[model samples]
Target: MTCARIPTKYGDFQLCYYTNTLDKKEHLAFYMGDVSEADDVLVRIHSECFTGDVLGSRRCDCGEQLDRSLQMIANQGAGVLVYLRQEGRGIGLLQKLRAYNLQDQGHDTVDANLLLGHGADERSYSLAARILEDIGVKSVLLMTNNPLKISALEAEGIKVNKRVPLEAPVNSDNESYLLTKVQRMDHLLQFAPPSKPIKQRAL
Candidate 1:
């Protein structure tokens, strides 16, 4: 495990890089503030989401989660954000876009991927676990709504002390998408109670 100081526009952060034998891949972790010990760390293993993250597409809540995690870690004054480069759930951008095309034809996210000759999710977290170990994080309060992330990290011997949920505001365009995530993807989302209807202003 080797640590290097990475200078970013936001701030200078300590990055720990390491190679994983099991996955045969290299991984990195961006450390914020002081996180030398185990129990005192807050971590977020963020998978890459290009459409929502970079293009601000309303397909899913990826960008929102990323923003929320950054803000949360900044507020905590100490934490690490392990940004894994697993784009499109590890299917890469091309297949992801193809899946999006299928999705536009009324297919669900999972079915679209399956239709495109891909699995439900092609992501792997072994590299993330290795990176965390390299940084000496024994335990962490994981910021995510995905239960699979918690289980994956725990399986790799990284102690997940707690789960910090990141839920975004649901809108008309993304209501069904959110429902699919909660039901199909097994995300931890407590649906907000229906609010009083607001009167529409006349044009």
Candidate 2:
């Protein structure tokens, strides 16, 4: 459970960087604040998104979620953000871009992934759980909108004390994508009632 210190431009953080021998790929756990002392720590298990997180692409809410989690933790003055290096839902950047192309052709996010021969959600949370245990966080208030993340963490014995929903502003371009998440992915999005049907005038 011991971790090594890692120096970064953002700030120096204690990290347990290693490859899951099961997957045999690189992953990281970033420790912040007095995680061992706090009763319920703040945590964010974030997936890597190059286009949306770094490039400000509006295709998805990944970057905004990352920013929001950082601000919330900064305000709380405690927490950890486990930045899992699973780019493009673990299929990597090139495939994600190809999925984007499929999206442009009218495929929803899930469909795009399927079209590109990838699972709808290739990300996992086992590493996050291991990292949390290593850092001595007994329980946490997880910052996320995805219920699956909450479930995954809890399933792995990372006590999730609460679920903090990260709701981003919906725009025309990403509306369908969000809707697909709600309907297909079991995301906890509150759907507004349908508006009354418009009265049509005879032509």
Candidate 3:
């Protein structure tokens, strides 16, 4: 892993890059403080969301979650945020946009991905675990809504001390998308009712 200083509005972080033999993609880990040989380190395994993270699109709450995670870690004075390069849950950008078009036509996020011949979520946490190991993290207080992340990391021998829920406000634009995650994909998310009922199709 090669690391360099990344100064952000929240705080100063060391952005480390890693390349795995499993794929050609370069994954990143933005971290603060001394987590080396630390236990119960605060950590977030975030999948890449081009539309949501970069474009700040309201179609999903990924950008908000990413910002919140950074701020939370900054407040705590220590943590690791692993940014996986798994676009649209590993379907890549082109197909993700195709899925988005399907979603616009009323299909929920999961069904749209399935319609495009991809699993609802194709992300793997094996690389995340390896990154943590490389950083010498003994255990983690994982910040995430996806239980699959917890399970996948644990399965790879990364001890998870606890699961910290990362919740984002629901808006009409992304209510159905978030709801589909909670109801269909078993994500642990809590939200107040959207200000108004969305007319999106049922999951």
TM-score per prediction, in order, is 0.84, 0.83, 0.93
lDDT of 3 by residue, 1-203 (tens): 68999999998999999989999999999999989999989999999999999999999989999999999899999999999999999999999999999999989999999999999889898999999999999999999998988999999999999999888877878888887887788888764334435454332
Cα lDDT of model 2 by residue, 1-203, tens digit: 35787654445557767666667666776666688856688898988888878998888878888877777776776788888888987889999999889988888888899988899999888887887787788899988878889988889998888988877777666666767787778887554422422122111
For candidate 1, write residues 12-65 as lDDT tens digits.
677876666565445567777877665858898988787887888788888888
Q: What TM-score does model 1 achieve against the real structure?
A: 0.84
Residue 140 lDDT, candidate 2, scale 0-100: 94
RMSD (Å) per prediction? 4.3, 5.1, 3.3
lDDT of each: 0.78, 0.78, 0.91
Name the better of 2 and 3 by TM-score: 3
> Model 2, which residues run further than 4 Å from truth?
1-16, 190-203
Cα error of candidate 1 at position 80, Å:
0.9
